[model samples]
Target: MEAGGKMMGMQLSWIRNPQVSAMLLLAAAILGLVIANTGLGPGLDALKHAHLPFTVFGLDLSAAHWVTDGLLVVFFFVVAVELRYEFTQGDLNSVSKAAVPTIAALGGVALPAIIYFNVAGADGAQGWPIPTATDIAFALGVLALFGRRLPTTVRALLLALAVIDDLIGIFFIAVFFTESVSLPHLGLAAVGIVAFWMLGRIYRGKRGSWPLRIALLAVALITWWLVAMSGIHATIAGVLLGLVLSPAPAESARERLEPFTNGIVLPLFAFTSASVIIPQVPLSELSPVFWAIVIALPVGKLFGVTIAGLVGQAALRVPKPDRMKLSELIGIALLAGIGFTVALLMNELAHRSAEDLIVEGTLGVLAGSLISAVLGAVYIALLSRRYPAVDSTERTARDSEEYLRRTDSE
Candidate 1:
């Protein structure tokens, strides 16, 4: 029994590890792609396209939709909680702390979009949002795997930047992708979201109160359903609830839900999204949407982030000790291109009407993200050689001491 318990604990630890989770996500995508090109492709495609038998609050969706719309909402909730934490108590708590990264993030968004529009043309305008995302898990995974010698400041900057980039992607989904909004359903969802916020605040200190937790969960589901029926993306509901929930309970929810998201929700979505048959055409014959994403993601992100970060630093006249060097900023910018998860989702939403574009866009996202991951890994590894390794435990201790010292002085 003890041995079994230990194994279970190890499994949970692995699920919670960002590096391991990112590797698993990549593996799942590769597996799906491989299987999709094989003889078993039909079966896998059938499974993904198969609609579930029942409808919940008028949501009758396919297996793939269930992952994207349902399970992925939980992932967004965790993201939103982390975002709120950053804005309140973490790296983005103040203007001075947030300005450079926020500017860099905006650059990351704008350049890729401009490149996509230029490449794909006006008819392909809807697909411009595809390359604007930065997958937080994949970006963090690459950093954790290869950035051990890198300063904590770099990690914090990357985290803040990715969070902000996702916020933009969420905005695109809410504003651009939403077609027709049902005011009645949206009004109800707003009320439910408010109630959710109130419940979280009331139960903020009551960690053991299962009854209230269950009630919160019920309200959350109802809000999600209402948002879905209201013609807005259901994931917006998660974002709303996460933003409004009291900090104490929000943090608690993030911790508890991380494993479920990392271990199951993400990998499943990756597999389903990446399960597209590769287009059998020559590169020249491929749609411009494919080439646009492939180019915009890595190249645009690299230049966009580096330029914006340097400009922000220069304009602010940041001190030498506090500002990152150009080389280090470039490395982080490379990682900003790793927009696998959200990029795939955006590709689906953008090209859903055109079957051919959807397949091409999927390939584009996978290929683009893979290129970013490889480039980021190689650059960061070489970069790590310039800096001596720092133990995370020791760093944590030093940070704690510094915090206490600052608090005493204040």
Candidate 2:
């Protein structure tokens, strides 16, 4: 009974977390900015450039690179695994349910790119991808503060929107962010994925076997290396490897993985990948890159997602959350604009040629993320009214089913 009570308390807190997680996320993000901006300026820089014993075949890597490439690989793997799970059994399972968020994601992707290109692309539109990021964990963490105030349907809707956003972000990274494609190597990557898939089929019986899962993990890492060497962002390898290394849908292996993703992978990723040192601000002159990122992330994402949601609703009557009015919708959309992780990647890839742009872009991510969190938190807190928790549990079950369907699907 004690254990059961604790579980219920956690779930209810998660369902209506009184904004604890959300506040934590915001605090962490803001703390990152403070660390970067404060007097430890030189220390942070040294840490980023610090030499690590991260040697592989005598290959040299810095602490920052290790975080971005090595540790963050686990992050992307978690995301890809969830994506696969969703397709098999969760929210993306049915066409009716999937269509609305998918289209919303598309609109969200398109508008940000267009806005960023037009605004920051002064040098022939180079930093176009900077705005196409939606930092889901940060936003959802903040939403946790509202607890029972948010309807389960709305929560599910927000999650679906973010996942779809991630899919689109992955595609854009593959196509636009690559410097040049090495076809021969790319071919090898394709072969590696296919070969692994075949191996997975042979290993199907080992879905729940710990030893087998361990072996496959090593193979997936090797495959990831090959894909990264092939000039494709190594992140795609994480996604593709997930598709091949997935457990059979009927099994319950995913729930086992869920805790790690939520508790460890995301938090670790946030901690490691989020250590941006705030550049010296000329508070007087925020660069165009800064303004572009500021506008593109929050304004563009909100504009794209909210309008897309409205349209999807009008066209297909995508069901809205019960017991909450339309005001909650805007809050959800605002949170969608908090593009931290993905935006950081785009800042790395798109702004590579101009380090200054990367610095400015970081500022935009910080500002936009803060505004979105504050506004979303406030909106939910103000509007949270009496409502039943049935919908929250219902969505949880549905999400699980959708996840099951995804990993099992062909």
Candidate 3:
């Protein structure tokens, strides 16, 4: 039992490592691209599109759909838990702390969409959401590479902005992308959500409640199914169920599930989503949808976040201590453009009907994200030189002394 516990601990620690997860995702995308361009392309393509019919659920989904709609739910569930914590207890718990990031996130969303709309014209307008996402894992992994001496405020700002960006992305998925909503199925999903909430109350802190765990799983699955039938994106079910669960149990679930999500679900999704045939056409012949996302993600995010964050900081009179310098905000903005996972998902959803446009958009996301990654790294490395690293031992001792001082006063 002890050995098994140790193995589980190691697995959990691995999942928590942002740099490793980012590298795995990057590796998966590269593998997919290589496989798709090789003689094995046809076999991989067949595997991706092959459908397994399920009459009971009235579903006949492709293998790729199973990865996107079913397995990706685990990723969204973890995101929802993080969102809940941020709103309730973390940096976003107050208006003062949340103001700049919220405004910056909105600017990040709006400007990219506007840029895409103008660049792509009316026919390609649906792809506006493609550049609006920020893959927190990728962005933070890049930050970790050069931010060892950066101020704590820079990381905090990035985290807040990313969380808000995710919230906006989820809203776009639920509102703008949903096809047709079935009231009856949505109602059923609500019922499942309520039941899950009730069970969460009963099961809170009951670490060994296997029966409760089983019941919660059943409810979650039912909710996902109902949402899928309702013509809503099925991943929203994961978000709703995650938000309704009690915090302790929800966190426990996230920790337990993170390994599978990081190791299997995300990498698989990345591979499947990226396994597209490269267009045989020249650069001039590529669709406007491709060029739009390519330009919008990095340029749009940099301008949008920097301008909006600066304006919001000025307008709100954010304290000097809390306010980020212009360079720091710009660095974070560039980092925000590393929209690999969520941007790719949005690309698939937005251009699902246009096969050529889908391929173009995928390539666009990869290229744009790569550019952002390189530029962000350079900017962060330069910025890091301006700040010296804090001594870990001294910082910890200082924090402990402060805490004791406060305790004595209290």
Candidate 4:
């Protein structure tokens, strides 16, 4: 048990290492691209659709579906935990703290959808949700690369916005993408959720309670299966379970699972989702779906987030010290365009039936996110030069200490 505990600790530490996680995601994506374009493409494609021999509760799915529908739950679970933390104790603990980002996130979602709708027109309009997501890991990873010159507030704002954006994406997945509903299965999932919640309350802080842990895991898996059967995305199961778990256990679970989600789950999902054949069609001949996503992500996100943030700051009469500067808001907006993970997931969910559109959509996400990253990095670098690095360092340390105090008190 001690050895297991130590191993888990090391794994948790690795998950906390942002640079490593980002590099893993990037490397996986590059490898997927390379493999998809090579002679191995057909074999990889076959493997993706290859079904397992066993079925769970009469449900059999392909390997790719298993990865997306099953393993991605872990990623969403971690995200839900982070969302809960932010809402309860972090930057989004209060309305004032949340207003700007929430409004910005809404704008971020709305405008990109509108842009996609207008650009793609009626025929290709189904993919409006494609550009509405912001990949927190990729965005933060880029911010980290630029060093400490940027204000801690920038990171805080980006995190808040990204979290809200994720909440919206989850809503879209649950509502828009669901093909049908099974009330009986949904009720079963609800029962599992309630049991999970009850177990959490009873087992909270009971370290080394292996039986309780096993029970909770069983309930979570059952909940996921039920939700999947109900025609809702299985990832919703992760969100529900994460939200219901007692705070202490939720944090512990997140810590334990983060490494696997970051290092394996996310990277594998990226690899599989990105393994699309590059279209041979000329750029001009590409469908509007391609251009819509390509344009909406970087351009739409920047316009939406910046405009909404500015309007929200004005409307809310946010204090000057708390208000984000125009340059900072622009930088955050640009970063919001790096919609990698969730964007890819949305693409798959949105264009599952249309193979040609899927290829185009994947390419668009990659292109748009890359453009956003490059532009956001340069903008932030220039913005950072205007601020004194010493001040940034002091502010960051103070913020960290404050955060620790809050956590301990909570």
Candidate topping TM-score = 4
**Which candidate would rank higher by lDDT, 2 or 3?**
3
The models' CA-based lDDT, in order, is 0.88, 0.66, 0.86, 0.88
Model 1 over residues 94-120: C-alpha lDDT tens digits? Answer: 999889999999999999999999998
Candidate 4 C-alpha lDDT tens digits along 105-217:
99999999999999999988889999999999889888876635877788999999999999999999999899999999999999999999999897765755889889989
Alpha-carbon deviation at 5 in model 2, angstroms: 22
Off by over 4 Å in 3: 1-7, 53-56, 390-410
Candidate 1: list runs displaced more than 4 Å. Answer: 1-11, 392-410
lDDT of 2 by residue, 283-344 (tens): 65867777777787777877887787677777886445422245666777787887877777
Colliding residue pairs in candidate 4: none
For candidate 3, what is the lDDT?
0.86
Write model 3 residue lDDT over 1-410, tens digit each, in one string. Answer: 32353357454665666777888888999999889989999999999988875653786688998888899988999889888877877778898889999999999988988999999999899889999999988888788777767876788789899989988888888998888999999999999999999998887657548798899999999999999899998889988988888875676677578788888999999999889889889999998998999999999999999999999999999888767899999999999998888899888888888888889999999989999999999999998998878787985575456433322221
Candidates 1 and 2 compared by TM-score, better number: 1
TM-score of each: 0.93, 0.82, 0.93, 0.94
Residue pairs whose backbone atoms clash in candidate 3:
none
